[model samples]
Target: MTDRREWPLYEVFVRGKRGLNHVHVGSLHAADSTMALRNARDVYTRRNEGVSIWVVPAAAITASSPDEKDPLFGPSADKVYRHPTFYPIPDDVPHM
Candidate 1:
């Protein structure tokens, strides 16, 4: 006999505000895409904690491993010149 107890895994992304990018919160399982989305909303956004939510299949998620992280993100560590430290901003600047 075969067991029919498996469900698709979903990854959740939530945005804090209307104009912000969605940040990954967590993952869960559901039967279908629509159900997965609804489950995510209920699971991650119980208190209106986020303005938006995104759910994608966990299988679709592709990422570099820790061993590759150093080589992948290491370039940014040495590129201090790319930072705003060299750029002189007026004290009057609001967010800068």
Candidate 2:
């Protein structure tokens, strides 16, 4: 049998039946992607709450660090056009 310690870490994302996007659920160590996906489903969706599961190898993910948030995201703060504050919402708009 393969050693558990040799397994690679995986990040799990699960989409609930009522959710429109896949949310990061948790992480696990698995021998491969298939096993990671199965383990994620079993661990995170035991109650049948999730409709989809995605497992990505931890090393495969590249994320910005919180410490660098200002330098990375600060430029976007001055882009006022990105915000919809100037628009008036109509009553007929469902989610607005």
Candidate 3:
């Protein structure tokens, strides 16, 4: 008997060579975790633009919608100290 259930959807993240963070690249449907990883690699890193890959189930991510922007991120606006403008960045800092 063939399994008829739909494959789970996975979100793919790729970290470029000089990147400090993993950026969301795309999504794919896979039967299992291993397959998801492999598929993500083939689909997102085909040009070797990424040095690392991450795959997370689409259902696992929690995102705030544009309509909720004020309520979700409004608190940070009042915290001026967190802006990092008080510190002077050294000219030697690469990619800063």
Q: Write the per-residue lDDT of candidate 3 for residues 1-96, one digit (tens) a residue.
A: 997989999999999999999999999999887899999989989998899999999999988899999988998889999877898889898764
What TM-score does each of the candidates earn?
0.79, 0.78, 0.69
Per-residue lDDT for 1-96 in model 2, tens only?
Answer: 865467899999999989999999889988899999888978899998899998999999999999999999999999999888899999999995
Q: Which is the better candidate, 1 or 3, if ranked by lDDT?
A: 3
Runs in model 3 deviating more than 4 A are 1-4, 74-96
Clashing pairs in model 2, backbone N/Cα/C closer than 3 A: none
TM-score of 1: 0.79
Q: Deviation in angstroms for 76 in model 1?
A: 2.7
Clashing residue pairs for model 3:
none
After TM-score superposition, what is the CA distance of residue 4 in candidate 3 from its true location, in Å? 5.1
Best model per TM-score: 1
Per-candidate Cα lDDT values, in order, are: 0.88, 0.91, 0.92
* Candidate number of the best lDDT: 3
Worst 10 residues of 1 by lDDT: 15-24
Question: RMSD per prediction, one decimal?
Answer: 2.2, 2.9, 3.8
Spell out the clash pairs found in candidate 1. Answer: none
